[model samples]
Target: MVDTALFTIRDERLSLILTRRKDPPFEGLLALPGGFVHAQEDADAEAAVRRVIRGKIGFDAPYLEQLYTFSGAARDPRGWSVSVVYYALVPWPLLEKNTSVELCPADELPALPFDHHQIVAKAVERLRGKATYSSLPAFLLPGEFTMNDLHRIYQQTIGARLDKASFRHKILEQDIIEEIPSRFRTGAHRPAQLYRLSSKTLTAFERKI
Candidate 1:
């Protein structure tokens, strides 16, 4: 089986997408989006996961990475099974209108079946660890956003407050985002310049924030 732990920042909270199973052995229970790998169609585990996400979520995830493999006889109810897990990040707006799935807080998920909870925990740990020195958290934001928006996302995903000035300088120095020739006005403050990622790829830094 191929499973995905899809994450997003919704209402300033880091949340994950889960769907209810319609069939057994865990019928009517919430679980990560997953399906059995198609032996003839899927070229690789990654491609299998991509097909699963598109079929379930109605869109392709902007950021997807192989997380870990979990295998054991006790993990599944039907004999022994191995699950190749992947973690994905998408902007909230892409999933806000999708009623087929549930968005739950990543840190407070309920007891899940088939070792899914353990998989989610591992994925969260990986995301938080990567956010400290890479542009991984930015995938949670929309295509066009302000520097402040990016800063808040990093803080939320990393689960800590950051020095605003330091973060700004460090991110700017990385040169990963470019000005969008637009501005966003928040209440009485001056319009903040809008920016977009320079490349649709992850950026790793030499030092942690």
Candidate 2:
């Protein structure tokens, strides 16, 4: 089985982790980070996906979800194969500090081996679509932030501008975040209220998906 991993980087750019293939079928070309599931070592598809990610990228994602599965005889050169795909989100700040792996922009990628490009495109689409009603975009931000910070992340993820007042109203009504009482000091202005995800689990903010 095959597996893929995605992470968001600075400036709200979504990137996919890719490594050069050194084996047969397609050698010396960049492709999604993946490996065959070792039946003996893995208890399930999810476990194998996690193992592939940890071994390749060396970091556990704050949020990880199964994107889709692709299967067919022609998909792989070595007989028939099935691929379980997953997309993960990590704060941009965390991505900048990690240097273990290379991240390629999902939308502006080079020629990829096999059907990896298709997998990246599908993952990107799902992330943007779900950002509208879910808390998925919060994974791109820091733990403590102001309303403006949260709003900007959402707007960037969805690729649309939102009215400041309206967006604030919706966020407050949803009760997805809670105020920290303490304020974040900004230069030459009153302190801004700090906010964070009310629930510790990233996906627990909303269950719309």
Candidate 3:
């Protein structure tokens, strides 16, 4: 089995997708998007997961990373089962575009089937653990946004408010984001400049950002 813990931001809140299962073993209950491996059609594990997510959600996430492996004799009712889990960061706009799925608050997920509750908890842990020192939260935003916008999402991801000056200083010092040539308008206020991730991958610093 392959399951994807896909997360997105809405109204400055971090949330993950959960679909109601219509099949046996947990019909009518909420669960993560997943399915069995298509060994004959998929070339590899990553491809299998990509297929599972796309088939289930009708959208592809930008950042897909392996979370962990879950296997046990009784984890699933169908004999001994193994599930390869992946965690992803999806752009909020894309999530908005896809209306078939439901976004559950990452911290307040309801009861889930099998080991899905554990899977979501781990995915949240991974996101929050790397949020402070990396550019992981940027994937939750659009291609262009303001420093204040970035700060708000980061605070939502980490569940802690950050000082404006301190947050701006850390982001600029690391140089992970580049300011755009254009500015965004806020009603009755000065136009704020937009920024986006400066590179393809996030770089780790000697000290946490």
Candidate 4:
């Protein structure tokens, strides 16, 4: 199974979690955390991904989904091999800085060894597309955040500016989120209500899809 864990972007940079192979055939080259699926394990793709992440990256992913399968003679140097690619989404704060399993910013990602660049491009496209009609981007935010926080994430994921009033209206109308009783006071501006994801709304959206 091929696992693609997308590190959260912070300070206007996208990060990816990669591991240096300790064995031959692409040894020492940074690649997405993954490995071969064991024959004895569960047949579920998500479970296989969790197993791969635990074995290769030493962490259980918070978010994961099947991306696609790659099966081509030229894709792998090991003769004939079929890879099941999975996408992992990680929040920014969950990542450690300057460490082995740490984040590698998009701007500084060195030349990747295999078809990783293509995999990443596809993952990004999926992320953006999902962000438009789903609450996938909410996974990137902290436990408590402002409307501005939600808006910024939407803007970043979709790469566009959203109308503030319409954004707020649609979000509230859909009942996807609820304001927390507590308010955060930042600077001299009026206190803004902190909001959290609504479980009911999430369930509704999932059923719709």
Candidate 5:
């Protein structure tokens, strides 16, 4: 199985977590965090994903899902190999402060090796769809955040403008989050309510959608 991490824009710049190949084939090229499945290992895809993320990126991912499998005969340069891709959601602030592999932003990324570019593009498309139909974007949010913060994440992930009133209505109607009684006073405007994601509510919301 192949494990991939989808890193989003952090501080106004798009970025993804990748690793430099240490061997032949795609040596020296940056690619998503993943590796081939080893025999006698757990057959669970999620387990394989966690192992790859921790081994390659040096961090444990909290959210992951099976993406797709690429089995084209000529896809792999090492004779023939099938890849079972898995997608991981990572928040910007959760990244490690120091990394050896060049963590270039999306716009400045150099040419990638193999079919990695195609894999990244497909993972992004899947994220956009999940953002619209599920509470997946919540994975990108910090433990606590404001309504505005959530709105901004949604806009960035889905690449669309959302009406303030409509967005608020839908979120509240879904009841997937709880507004913390404490208000954060950041600016001169009225204090906005802080919210915490509710596990029960999130499960219900996904089911409803």
Candidate 6:
């Protein structure tokens, strides 16, 4: 079996996606979106995850990464089951207008069915650790955003306050984003220049930010 822990930023908080089970074992209980791997159709664990997410959520995740494998005689009631786990990061805009799954703040999760709570914790830990030195949190924002938007997402994901000047300097020095020429978010104060990711792929920084 394969399971996915989908994450996104909502209302300035890091959030996770959950669905209620409809069948037995844990009927009506909240669980991460997942499904069994099809022997013939799925070429690998990642392929199974993509197929499951597409079928269950009706959209493709922007960023997905393999997390860990969990297996034990008692992890599942069905017995001797092993689960290949994956975590996906989706931009809030991508889910805002498309998905109807329940969104829960990652820090205040209730009891989950199976060992899903452990899976979630592991996923969050990985994301936060990576955010310290990579452009991982940028995947939580829309394609185009201002520096302030980027800053807020990073703070939320990292769960820490950053000095604005230092944060901006670090981000600019990393060269992960490129300013959209002549584009600015105009408001009462000076317009903020808009920028976008240099590439859709994730970039790792040589030094921690």
lDDT of 2: 0.77
Q: Which regions of candidate 2 deviate over 4 angstroms? A: 183-185, 202-209
Per-residue lDDT of candidate 5, residues 99-164 (tens digit): 554566655667777677788788778777777866777777777788888878887777677887
Give the worst 10-residue stretch by lDDT in candidate 6: 92-101
Ranking of all predicted structures according to lDDT, beginning with the best and ending with the worst: 1, 6, 3, 2, 5, 4
Full candidate order by TM-score, most accurate first: 1, 6, 3, 2, 5, 4
lDDT string for model 1 (159-193, tens) is 99999999999999999899976556467887888
Residue-pair clashes per prediction, in order, are 0, 0, 0, 0, 0, 0
Candidate 2 lDDT tens digits, 86-159 = 88777767666556566777678889888887888888888888888877888777789889888888887777
Which ranges of candidate 4 are over 4 A from the true structure? 55-59, 105-108, 183-188, 200-209
The Cα RMSD in angstroms, rounded to one decimal, for candidate 5 relative to the true structure is: 2.9
lDDT of 4 by residue, 1-209 (tens): 55565557577555677888788778888877777666687577677778877765566656677788877777678777677888776666656443566567654676676677777778777777777887777767767778988888777766667898888877777678888876674767878888988861222343221
What's each prediction's TM-score? 0.97, 0.87, 0.94, 0.83, 0.86, 0.96
Candidate 6 runs further than 4 Å off: none
Q: What is the lDDT of residue 111 in candidate 5?
A: 78
- Looking at model 1, report the run of 10 residues with the lowest lDDT sum: 181-190
lDDT of 6 at 140: 89
Model with the higher lDDT, candidate 4 or 6: 6
RMSD of 2: 2.7
lDDT tens digits, residue span 1-209, model 3: 79889888876678888788989998998889888888799887789989978876676677788999999987888788888899988877876666678888887888889989889889889888888788888888878888988899889988888898989998899888997776664767888888878986756655655
Q: After best superposition, candidate 2 residue 149: deviation in angstroms?
A: 2.0
